[model samples]
Target: MNKCVGTTEAASLLGISSRRLRQLLEKGRVRGAYKTGKFWIIPLFNHLPQITKGTRGPKGKWRTSRPPALAKINVNRNHIGSNIKKSPKDRKPVISVKRKGTNLYGNEVEILGPCKIVYQPDNPLDCGARLWIDLRSRYANETFSDIHFIGGSFPATR
Candidate 1:
């Protein structure tokens, strides 16, 4: 039941900008903000900056989950996903499969395990679906690493 804004309205209400809210208020991380004279007095937080759990998107590897066996670090011959060029037995590293997609909270998902594939490529929108195995069942974790579909003949369980 409290509020307090300034410093560019608390960095535009936490959308973050005003010089990153003055570097999070000089690294004090706002909280109750202070510093008068030149103004800073910020303290409006209806929830915005906590975002933990692997720190999602922008290369933090999103929720992680992707590198279970990107071809076990490619033992030698390369090529997998997009940029097609298959060799090492038609390359395959990039696991986690459970089908029926839509995760990250959009719900309607149906993969009881694994799911991590990504090869985005859309010239105005290709449609082969370019890989993108998908995960997010809370970062699905059954100890992962199926060794590229275990002893071959895949079938971890439909």
Candidate 2:
């Protein structure tokens, strides 16, 4: 029979923590290691098992696969509001609006743009749609009773 040592002695010899040795023993990563009574018996001559390093978390299709393409939005002229018309001639040069907020992924996101949607990703993981509106716009500063959309009107915020 091979000479065996306790987990503490084996951990010290292997230059690792006793708790880490216990984990390795439990996972069957430690060679010539076995449980006896309430303690672990590791062979004295055994070395630390080779551990392959790769991506830390679980492997899934999201790691190797590309995100889906963004859906194209076709704007109908009849559905557009008179005030909110999409005319290149009526478009004005506005200052960039910057806002800092947290995304659904709990990441700190800083958005900078004019009075329109700044970024619309090709494929969104959390929310499919992201509308960025500048609060410094002329209409934003004015006190409006209701805000008009393409389909309906919404209550304005104070």
Give stretches of model 2 more than 4 Å off: 46-158
Query: What TM-score, to 2 decimals, does candidate 2 have?
Result: 0.29
Pairs of residues at least 3 apart in sequence or in different chains that clash in candidate 2:
none
> What digit string (tens of lDDT, one per residue) describes model 2 on residues 1-158?
55677888666655567887787678776666778899987774323233223345553111122122111121222223442665754432221211122112111223232224334466432434333332223332211122222323222211
Candidate 1 minimal-lDDT segment of 10 residues: 70-79
lDDT of 1 by residue, 1-158 (tens): 55566777455444557885676577675566778988777654442222222233353111112223222111111222331665655444333333223112111223334566455565211333443444422232322333223343332322
User: Candidate 1 versus the native: TM-score?
Assistant: 0.18
The best candidate by TM-score is: 2
Task: List clashing residue pairs in candidate 1.
Answer: 96-114, 96-115, 117-133
Show model 1 residue runs off by greater than 4 Å: 1-120, 123-130, 137-148, 152-158
Note the Cα lDDT for every prediction shown.
0.40, 0.40
